[model samples]
Structures are given as C-alpha cells and as structure tokens.
Target: MTSHWPQPPTFRAPIQPRQAGARNGRFELALSRHGARTHIGRQYVSYPFHMTRPFAFDVAIPSLLTVYQQSSSGGLYRDDRLDSRIDVGAGAAGHITTQAATVVHDCHGQPAHQTTEIVLEEGAFLALTPDPLVLFPGAACSSVIQARLAPGTVLLLSDAFALHDPEGRGRPFERLEAKVDIRDAGGRLLVRDNLEIGGAHLSSAGSPIGDWKVVSNFMLVGAPDRLPTADELAVLGRPERQVVGITLLPNGAGWGVRCLAADAIAARVIAEKLFVLAVSAAFGQQPAPRRK
Candidate 1:
C-alpha cells in the first residue's frame, strides 16, 4: 500500500515598480530560495542620475533628486534578503535621499525573517534615511541590518517604525524583532542595537515605548573625534514635547541619537537637526538643503 501526501507550495518573491510620476527612481528585483539560502536573482534599478546593471553589491550614485522605492508585493516573507550598496558623493558633492517604506504583511500567526546589508564607502556623504516601517495588525516580522563604512564617510542613518490598523479594528501586531550593527573598515564593531515589541508588551503600561506612537533612531558615523561632544550633542538633541537622547559609540567611532515623538513629522524634525549637526561636524561645512 502507498500513502499520498500534499507537498508544500513553493514561494516566489515578486518585485513591483511604482509609477514614474512619483519620482525618477524605481527598483525591480526577484528573490529565489534554495533550501535554507535566499538569492537575489534578477534586478533592474533606475535613477535620474545614472543607470547600470544591478549587482549583489555596488555603489548607488543619485543626483539632486529624491529616490522613491516601494514593494509591489506589499510585504516580505520568510528568509528574504535585501542587500544594497550606496556611495553618496563618490568624489564630488552629491545630495540625494532614498525613502523606503517597508511594509510587512500578516503571516497567519507565523513570523517571517528578513536580512538587510548596506555598505557606504569613503568620500561619500549620504543621508540614508528611510521612512518608518508600518507594521499591520497581526503581522509578525524579524529584521536585521548590517552597515559597513570607511573612516572618511559621512552618513546620517535612521531607522524608525509605527504600528497601524487600517481596518479600524483594535488588533495589535504579533511581534517585531530588529537589530542593527555597524562596523568599521577593519571589521571592528562600532555600535549594536536590538529591539523587540509584541502584542502583550503593547498593552503593558511599563513598556519601554510607553505611549509613544512613533520612534526614530539616528546614527552619525564618520570621523569620530570630529563629531560633536557628549555635552554638545545633548544640547543639540533637546526639543520640546519629545523624548530625545544622544550618545557616543564605542572607540570614538560615531554618535547615536534616539527620539520618540507622538507623530512622524515631529520625529523627522528632530532627526533633521541631528543630521545637520552631524554633517557640519564631519565635513566642516553645512550640507545642501535636503529639499523633498
């Protein structure tokens, strides 16, 4: 006698490009799974400044335009990889912003894992900041980011998120686990951050997030000693009606700032100030106004 059983369905990651009316930027990519490993198979990226074949790792040069990116599939899945490489100035004065709105869909009580890696080389001055990640109700996600930078690199890196319930129902998200690690050229760790939030903790009064609907973290990595001092950074981060704090990274590698606000705009304002200060300190000059 022989028994019959249904096999699991194979999953294919889809890439969607938004309309060009929004901005002159878009990315189309596909992901395939081989056993436990995920590979970035095909990709097509367009920017106003230049066009080139998408490689697993390469520098991203953007002109004086805002690069807008979105996922057509709406969300990520289990064991997905999102790797990117960006070079801001490249050798001349370059000013560009890439805004990524990463949305994770509900997984039917199962959690999905995604890995992201970014590299910013020397002589690059970039504001690699993404809009807050919006987690839908009942969605569970785990994300990790690794950034490698050179000594002369000036960067304003930000990570933030907010919860959402579009259906008007009060259901909370399942869980969000995230971590960020920054390393120097010699593979030495400069900063490490970890965050975890679940449904139960959301209802707890003692939750670390406490009533703050929007949380943003900004880190300035470059010439460590040239950055602002602890006392100066503290003064620069202070703002009304918001909780903000700044600290120095280990071994004088850089500085990190954490801000919590009642809304996204407020958080962005705080981040902007920090970005300006960091850029001025790193390059000894004010950066071109980030018009978006």
Candidate 2:
C-alpha cells in the first residue's frame, strides 16, 4: 500500500478470492499518443471491471480518446477491496466516464474499500467525470482517489455521491469516508480533501442536506490558459435548489468547484457544463456531444 492509503480493517469477501493489487479484481490502464491520436498502450482488467474500445468521436478534438468504464457485478459487496489505476503518457489526451452510477450496497458489518490512482506525464490531458455513487442503507465505504501530475499536464476530476434506501425505510448509509489527494510529479503534495460522514447525521435537526440529495466536488489542475474564464462560467447560475462555490487552486494551478444539488440529475449538469466550458477554453472549440 502507498503511504497515503489508510489500511483497511480485516474481513472476508466471498465474491473475489483476492486482495487489492491481486489478479482477481484489479484493473489498470495506460495510454499514450500513437502518431496523432492517443491509444491504450497497456491494459489489464479482471472480474467486475470492463471498458469499451477507445473512440475519437469529437470532431473538434479528433485526436482525443473517449472511453466508458463499466462494472459487471450488480453492486458493491461486503469486504470488497477494489483497486484501479490509470496512466496518461506524455502528450496523450483522453476523457473517461462511467456507463452509469455505481450502487454501493449494504456492506453487512464490514466496510467496502476502493482505491484509484491517476498519473499524468508532461503535456498530458485527462478528464474523468463519473456518475455519483448511490449509497444504500447500511452502506459503509472508504474511497480514495490519488493523482500525480507532471508539469504542463491538465486534469479535470469530479467526485459525487447520493443517498438511497431501496426499501423506503428512510434509513441512510452507515458511513462514507472519502479522500482526494493530488501531488506533483516530484512527490510534492498539492492538495488533500478529506470527508467522513455518517448516515445518521444526515437526518438530524437542521441538516445541511435538508433538501439536497447529492454533493460533489470538481477539481481542475492546469495552466491558467487552460482553465475556464469567468465569462464562460456564466452558465452556472443560481438555481432553485443548487449551491456552488468556486475558488482558485494553490499557485494558480487552476480552480476547484463544490456543488450541492437537490438530485443526481442536477449534479450531472453541473459537471458536464464545467467540462464543456473548460474544454472550450483549453482547446478553442466545444467538443462534440457525448450522449449519455
């Protein structure tokens, strides 16, 4: 395990007979520029993980690759230790999104753990915008997303989650522990965001999420020229049940966004809007629509 990843509690998983980094469930992807377009240079995928063939559908940015990640298992299970990694070689550009939202089912008495690692070499660009995690009642999860970026690289990463009780019992998830860590290629830490919330606390008196059902954070790390301008961001107006906060990142690396939505649909709009705006600013043209 890396120094930043906290150790997981011991438990038994009946689904996969392996730990993280083992051959059973871990998936890894590496991409690099091949001539004028980016291609998957290396890949290894195991059970529960699959991906579509790379597509260069964006006419405005024909060289950029797009992929949809998929999970075959219906949902997360108790004591699941899933690991995934992606590497963007120098000068490669790509966008990756999930086929749909992931459901974090009840973990029984053990917590499910997931770790994601992303590395971007110089001049590489990557955008990762996945649907939110739907936390079911009694769901306990620990999620860590770590990124290492070299100089001249650009990254747009978003994370979001929402609560759901399939039985309509009004029960919330047991616990959710999430962390996002970003570092430079030299191993210097850039930013770290940590959040731990219990499901019960979400329903107490005067809850912050009184009406909102989803919360998300979107981060952009890149040169100023590649960031979104104030004018292009005007589309993010004050909606009826939405709240957003935007701030510049350290050393002007880029900007960060925190948004709250009444539902998952609203959160998706915010993420998609920001991606389009930033892409236009960086590449000088709006990308062709990526239909959901």
Candidate 3:
C-alpha cells in the first residue's frame, strides 16, 4: 500500500517477520516543542497508515500541532490488527485525530483489534480525540488504550462508538469492547475503564442504552489542582439530546466523564465542551473553537 504522509524526519522499519494476508501494522511518533511551535521529532508509519501534515489552527494555543491520521484500507476485516504509539516531550502540545469515523465491517467469528500507546513527559499537553468507530451488523471489535504520563502532563482524551446497519435492517452489531488504562511515569496503574456492549442487548426490551445511539468516555488527565470540581462538571450537559455525568477519577489521575447521546453530533458537542473546560484550566484562557 502507498503512504500519503510527507517524508518523515526520521524513519526506520524493524525486521519483524509477517504472515501472508496479515494486515497488522503500527506507527510511532515523538513530538517536541521548538521555540513556540511543536514539531514531530521522529516517526515510523507502516502499511495501511497515512497522515496529513501537522496544522496549527487553534489561535488560542498557537503551539498546538494537529495531525489527522488515516488508514489506506477502507475498513477493518476479520483478523485485522493495528497498533499506534505517540510520545509528547516536555512542554510540547499536540492533538491527534482521524479524518472520519472508522468503519468495522462484519468479521463473523474473527474480530478486528486495535491498540494505542501514548507517553507524555512532564509539562506536556496532548488531546487525543478521534471520530467514533462505527460497527456494522455482525461486526465485532476490540480497542484498548494505554497511557503513561508524568506528573505535570495534561491530556484531554476521548473514546466513542456507534452502531450501523447498511442493509436497511434493524440488526445490531455483534459486539464492541473498549478499555482505557492510565498509569504514572513510573508505570503504576492509576485507574482503568472498561466497556462492552452486545448488539442483542440493544434489541432487548429495557435496553441499558434506552434510545441513545452513541456512547462516549472523556478524560482530563493532569495534576489534581488543575481539575474541575464535581459541581463544575455536573453543569456540563443540557437536557436535550444527551445525558452526561462527570466525577473525579477515584485514583486521582484526573476527571472522567461518561456521556450517552442520541447521535454523533450530541456526543461531539459534549466532547468539545470538555475540551474547552480543560484548555481553560491548563492554558489560563478560553480556546478558539477548533474548526473541523
């Protein structure tokens, strides 16, 4: 497969053996601040992965670099595996996102898997927000995130998923499983979040999701003094189109929010609100709206 990314500053490939027809791939990047701008110091992206040049569009955080990741493949299939890693150096700022939602097609009995690892140095701030994964009928997928952050590091991260049926039928996806684990610089696990939903559950009477079509989890990880209070977070959502609740992470990594929305737009609105709040807390000013 061809890659769309600009030539990397530093690139290399390992000598790992591969199996025929295997779609396994991985990409790693390290970002650091130079003067007032953040730039990628190193990168290694393999097949099925492509990304656009970094853009600094947020006037409020001019140093913030934004990268849009893409996959050459149309969507995930049976036995597909993808892994990616990101490192933010001290004092660096960056945001990583996808151009569109990733579609997970029917995998029958073999599910697709994706894992991401992120590292943040002291004083670094990064936003990891990607479009939700859309699961088609009979699709099954598993996703996981592992983050190791220094004490002063800050992160505004989000995870979300939605279901779809392309044949005009009301069938739900087989299942979707997701997990997020946060750890300190010393590799001590602070907290973990797990989610699993089966399509059959949604079709049953008294479904836990009710009428909601999207599920989202947002986290603001940083020093305790920089997090919002429970009362402040309780006022984050409205009575229309969604439901949300926020509370301090019991292990004190930061704050965690659980949001359920009728659609992607509603979920996105809540995510943005959390971004704004987190930015104001970390940057000491209101951030300019990020234009998608």
Return the TM-score for each candidate structure.
Answer: 0.68, 0.89, 0.89
Off by more than 4 A, model 2: 1-24
What lDDT would each prediction earn against the true structure?
Answer: 0.57, 0.80, 0.79
**Whole-model lDDT for model 1 versus the true structure?**
0.57
Task: Give the per-residue Cα lDDT of candidate 2 at 285.
Answer: 82
User: What is the Cα-based lDDT of residue 19 in candidate 1?
Assistant: 25
Worst 10 residues of 1 by lDDT: 1-10
Q: Write one digit per residue (lDDT tens) for candidate 1, span 1-292.
A: 0101121232233544432232323344333333332333445654322333322211222222233343444555433344344433232222224344566656555555655555555554455566777777767777677777676766667777777778867577677777878787789887777766675556355656777777777777776555766766776533454698766667776777877787767767776677667656755655554543
Q: Count the backbone clashes (under 3 Å) in each candidate.
A: 0, 0, 0
Better of 1 and 2 by TM-score: 2
lDDT of 3 by residue, 33-99 (tens): 8988889999988878887788887776777788888889988776689999999999898888888
lDDT of 2 by residue, 49-138 (tens): 888788887876865888887898877776777898999999898888888999998877677788999999988889988889899998
Question: What residue runs in model 1 are displaced by over 4 Å at the alpha carbon?
Answer: 1-66, 73-81, 87-101, 110-113, 236-240, 288-292
